[model samples]
Target: MVIRYSFDSLQPRPIDLPTEVPLDDEADLSVLDEAKILAAPASRADVERWRDQIERWREEARSRLCYSGAQYDRIESQWAQTCFAVAQVWLWDELLYSFEDHVFTPQKFLADARQRLGGLDAVVLWHAYPVIGLDDRNQWDYYRQIPGLKELIAQFHAAGVRVGVDYNPWDTQTRRGKADVEELAALVADLGADAVFLDTLKTAEPELVEALERAKPGIVLEGESRVLLARIEDHGASWAQFFADSPVPGVLKSHFFERRHMLHHVRRWHRDHSEEIQSAWVNGVGLMMWEVVFGVWVGWNKRDRSTAARMLTLQRSLSHFLLEGQFTPLVECADNADDKLVFGSSWKRGTDTLYALVNRSEIPITLKPIREETGIVQLDLMTGAVAQHLAITIPARGIAAVMTSQGEINPDMIELASEVSAIELSDDARFEHRRVHRVHESSRSKNTGESGVLIEPGEYVLTVRYRGRETGMYDGAPYVDEWKPLVPRLHDPRTLERVTTLDNPVIVAQHEVTNDEFLHFVRESGYQPAVSNRFLLHVKDGVNGRGHEPVCFVSLEDARAYCEWVGGRLPTEDEWQIAGDKQGFQRLEPHVWNWTESEYSDGRSRFAILKGGSDAQYDESEWYFDAGVRPPDFSAKLLLMGLGMSRSERIGFRVAFDRRNK
Candidate 1:
């Protein structure tokens, strides 16, 4: 019982590579160097111009906040109107407070005029303190004294404004390990508070998270402070705090005053512990700012409010940035000791990457060079300055955003290939005793036997090779067979029913498309792969020797996209079968199981396609060790060739095409 396979019928259309351009002998390398030198100054100017152009582009790109330009404009206009309304109320409240003659609490004034102001994302309650010890004191006393606190909460909730309470954890109220912490939390929850702030609890104990969850299931929890308690715990600090009897010289420097200091502190906290912060945020906790009042104070009294305003604006901007979606931090850089000269944070949004950098120190920091074509936009968080390419010097305590457009690269352009060579098996009586045999020039010619069905009609570069032990007769072969043989069967020959199977024999490349190769495809096609569609694939033995390499995680859709881009199509299961030969007995060599064009179980499950031999090892004898064994008498062999296998990490492909009448 033997079956034959063919590769010719499965041929696919071939893509032509670009012709090489010949260089002239007169083209002097030194002249090129001289030209580079001459263009150096001009290049600098060009770079600056390019930066400006990029900035302009970024501004244009952000003209429409999200993707739609018109929708972005509408949203922007609405946001402005809303902000203006809020600003008007804020201005009115400030004036009334200044006059000291207005008879209204902050809560009441904001509440009564809520309808006039457009809906806000969130409503911030400024002065609600928390209850501390069973015996009221400080903020706890204030909380107990305010008869209108509960009413304020109800009013805000009714207005669809999620109320956030501002309470310092160390203020003898919300602090964990305190006598009445649980009681205060319970009371706050009962009052219908949407969220509670534990100011200065940068690293609220894990138990505290559990306690809060238990007290108010699903309630948003937030930690407010710049000390970076969790980060500091993870990465130790080595400085002692000492209070000077006399005031330190630069303690209140004009440049260091106001929210700039706060910004610096916040940047440091985020930079040092971005991962932990992101984790906490995703795990039912929100990050908050308490010293927004500092911005107002700086703006009102300091005459020089630019820095303070920038800081406040950046903080608000970051709040929205971090809360956009779930993210994992990739890189972070910050100065822990000085807390001043630090800044940098980045996250992956879908397929796009977004990054932000802040200049906390008075001196400007030239950031490390970034690739020009990564499609990053530098946004001035404070002024809404957007630039496609950015190299501007941020003013002291300034912030800039770099966002990469999502889904710009085409997944079809990504090309992946395996390093390991394919092998071919044979079914001749001479090779019966030895299941695996190395394919050489002579062997390939001898086993040309017959071609398989042409799965599709076009062009293909198919190379056949084989794997076997190094013997005196087969010297100078490519691969060496290292695995040992299995024991001979003991059952009666007549009683056994022979089961036939065909393994897809073409070995596809290993996991993942390389950065360089992906870049080339993008350059040629101007196509961007959707970030959401791209994935990392993983394989066990596919790594072969390089286990640390990037994994290739792709879907059948991704595979189809690549084939279409390269003028090919996926192979049908029958077509894949026709490419490999069946040897005697149930054993098939070289040809691993290949994916079929047909959907599994009638497409109910997309993953029904067969994969080759178990990459998973069975035993040391057959897969690992190779002790000597004699050849058998009546065995059979077949062309053993490597076949592509679909794996989360292995990047392999099959031939395909549109069916044509023949």
Candidate 2:
């Protein structure tokens, strides 16, 4: 099924014109900085001139900026060039970290990558942010506190995949730590990470570059967007996010300047990826496989996955053609010159010349002849069949490749051909959507002799307020098929009115559960959790002096255990809000978020709605978790993490019971 995009604005502009940079010797190349696609001249004769002008600019720019290729020259750094696929994976993604088992399953993650994505070359283990700044624990603590993370990295290495650690420059308001340079350098070295993904940064400062090198030699730095021209010398790759392509395929500035430099094309929130995949195909660049964006699932369709499998098959086998070959954008088709919907590029190295083509339209296109003048044997690289006329069909929004070689073909190419022949390319372009479901756990229906606020049974419309973040309030993507979410759409004040009906009356506690109250439950019940990590972290010396303070640092399960002992359960989001609307609902001093019986899962992520915001607020950056004292109507969806990382000092719980049970 073709998932029709209702919004015409979200449709890809196949004929989007590119920006032209001046060719003058003294032309300010800074004009080329933010360009999505550089324009290629329509006439064949003028295309040569266009190529020369860009080459001349690169030569002069290098001399003027004093560029150095020392980093790319290293054997360890060269992997980025052929790193065709890198997954921007959340550390707690369901495939990688199991919520039920409470363990990091690297084997499970790797197996999924191998099947769906044709395997990953590297993965950015995205931790913190969207969940960070909940308390004083800084970014480093997020990594350092995780158990067996190093072993997890080793497992990926054993599977022949490198790991990349993410560094967020916007993480300043959290607990003070060593300088960013020192902290990041130490992190990369300790984890033995192959690369560092710089979040919201184009390039690391010169000081940071040097410090990271000193700590771990040959470490690759991959910036968020376009890496600066001069800084591209040290930075191995740039995430070519939101890069729009021309009607006719054009050159990627950084990749054109330095063939070894890698760029992974990605649009985090976009569901359809045909445009970006085609863009990467012609440019011989990589693709970022980020199915789960933060906590939201923006997965690739079957067609896109099949296209990636074919692309990766060719790319992994023919790295020499992509890296060492001379690349020419918009290579002309010998016979089908009028086929505007189909564009091709040629790469030449040694005695071989390869042509890569993409069909941008919805109908299959047949190429009459290609590279016939080469007069050498033309082989369909994808099928391993020799083509006498060099004619082949490129499926709609799919890719095709043909290679002519005067020498013996590499064994790897033969293996790639054999592998791709077995793959049944899927044409189903339907978005695989996951719906979030509220997880319900059975609690004892015993009577608890505790006085509390009563919420009558009725249908009520609650005005729920929350910060509009990438994690949507209840379900669906926050930014649906958007290029880049900005301003009012992102991190803006959002209001949602939920109409809920309660069948039975509820008794909600007026105040949060205190430290002293939780200790008594622990002592009396003698409860022990399946995973003891980060349990009762605030309680020290077998005593918590602050008895009146709300109990914090307890996981959702721990809170449930305490509530079960008292013959009550946590309040539902609706029950909590209804009680808060009453006059008797009093917030405990030193406010902390209250956990509700609102645990939800979309299979990829688990989250619980938190009410009554905490006093701790990390300022200066909007990426931090929602903080500051909020009204009872306010709710924050906190993505639940395994191994007690979900437990926070700023989050607590209170009890509620059904009136009939009490």
Candidate 3:
């Protein structure tokens, strides 16, 4: 299917685009207010001091091993499937949150409770396990027996927020009540607790998950540490750190791409500086711990809300791809950040690819558009809106998930030659570890071979005949057939693997205008301080745009002056695109994205167009390569157009000499 985007004329023009689609703070889903939700179990042995543990074999049922083929030719597709459960959790400590000063204010506590549970749209609300009393003084044996506790649990349940009590199976002796497997199970069953944060997690054993399920069928059991043992029965998810937004900002890059099911709860995400929260999403982690529990829970402002809303918006859109697709790293920039630039990763489904690009630095970072891709878009995660492709700049500490829309190249479409060689198909299906079921058609050929899906082990190969194209004369003209090869996909699944890392945004400056050139412009026109690049000092590499290489950090004005001194002018956006395309002299496209004379809008501002794309990391769309290719609507020049103004690595003018001068 051809996916086309209809541009909205309402958006800012000549785009310097970064928009935040609004989101509803309160959820329509209400919590269960019925008293039955708070069932006080008789006795529970689990305690805070010592925790119990269990181990188990892997659970096969939790995973769906994909397969494709007919009865005779069954093929097992690659199961890179992940279940991205980026759950927003509200971890609350009842005692600490209940009292204000030395005195107890049940009203204040209740208000806080209402705000955390009703206001926040969290899938799970965590109630710390032990109900240790006010002073070390009041050690409440059970939470259900406490005053008004029943209402809280019921409210949480009514809101569809699963209550997760902290479970410490190891420390059974401290509690005077029955605290064994059965006791803990009964407690979770009664309190409507859907999950237990296993303190001091060892492994996600089947025994632990099974026992929990016995009491509460759909309850989730999270471990303190991230578990790699996908072996546990129902241990599909976990919580990583207390703070989702890392304290030492820029250090904690969330591995949501690799570990999709884990939730890195941002314990310290407060209102004042919410860049961390915004950065967390860009880093690919979902928003968490925005609650009224341990902290003051200051709400976000306009800017922060814009970004936070954007993050949540993306969560709702790409949740599936993150959860289901195998994580093939998109050659994003290295994790190392030196206060300036950063990048992201990508994933694929069939011929289509999607990328997650983010800028974790304080400075804006630009990138070149990736090659062999089309329909590039700077996706708005909030509303799934595709912003202008030309204005693709990841805001400082921000993210943009872009994808490629290309047609798929299938194998059957190609006609192969005869001469069955080393690439032979073993009639006997070896390695019976997996099963396959091809549900499509099976074509046969006499000389070359049969055309159909091959089901086998250890990376199945499609052995087809290949013959060079032959030209023939038809009634009116010469006819030639072009031979295409079966796009060599991965060994198992028919998924495409990208090895060449997505190119970084390009950099260009024709050996920044030399210091001599700058002096010449200054001498003739008296370099006006107000008009000159104020951020000139940023070009520490060169004081007066001297040297053999391009000048670094030259403001737009300086660039223009140096160009005019050299008797040249900045190329228009169209001209720049032509040059980038190599117009009549198309050489390998340069990584240096040169500047254009086009205004971001037709305004007086300096928001000019910058071309060739930034050589930075960028997202690839899953639809980048679809089947059924088409002729270009216009030409390649139209595809290479883009926009950018300030904060480039280096700024140098690309002179478009007049025809007479040329």
The best candidate in terms of lDDT? 2
The C-alpha local distance difference test score for the whole of candidate 3 amounts to 0.35
Worst 10 residues of 1 by lDDT: 415-424
Query: Model 2 shows how many backbone clashes?
Result: 0
- Report how far off residue 220 is in candidate 3 (Å): 0.9
Candidate 3 Cα misplacement greater than 4 A, ranges: 1-140, 147-151, 169-175, 200-207, 228-233, 242-260, 267-285, 290-306, 332-340, 350-352, 368-389, 406-662
lDDT of 1: 0.30
Candidate 1 stretches with Cα past 4 Å from truth are: 1-104, 107-141, 155-182, 198-215, 220-343, 360-369, 374-391, 406-662
User: Candidates' TM-scores?
Assistant: 0.29, 0.94, 0.39
List lDDT for all candidates, in order: 0.30, 0.83, 0.35
lDDT of 1 at 325: 33
lDDT of 3 by residue, 47-144 (tens): 11111110000012122322111211111101101212223332222222221121223344334433322223333433322112100111123344
TM accuracy, model 1: 0.29
Candidate 1 at residue 476, lDDT?
22
Question: What is the lDDT, from 0 to 100, of the residue 348 in candidate 1?
Answer: 55
**Model 3 poorest 10 in a row by lDDT:** 49-58
Model 1: per-residue Cα lDDT at residue 114: 31
Error of 2 at 108 (Å): 1.0
Screening candidate 2 with a backbone cut-off below 3 angstroms (N, C-alpha, C), the clashing residue pairs are: none
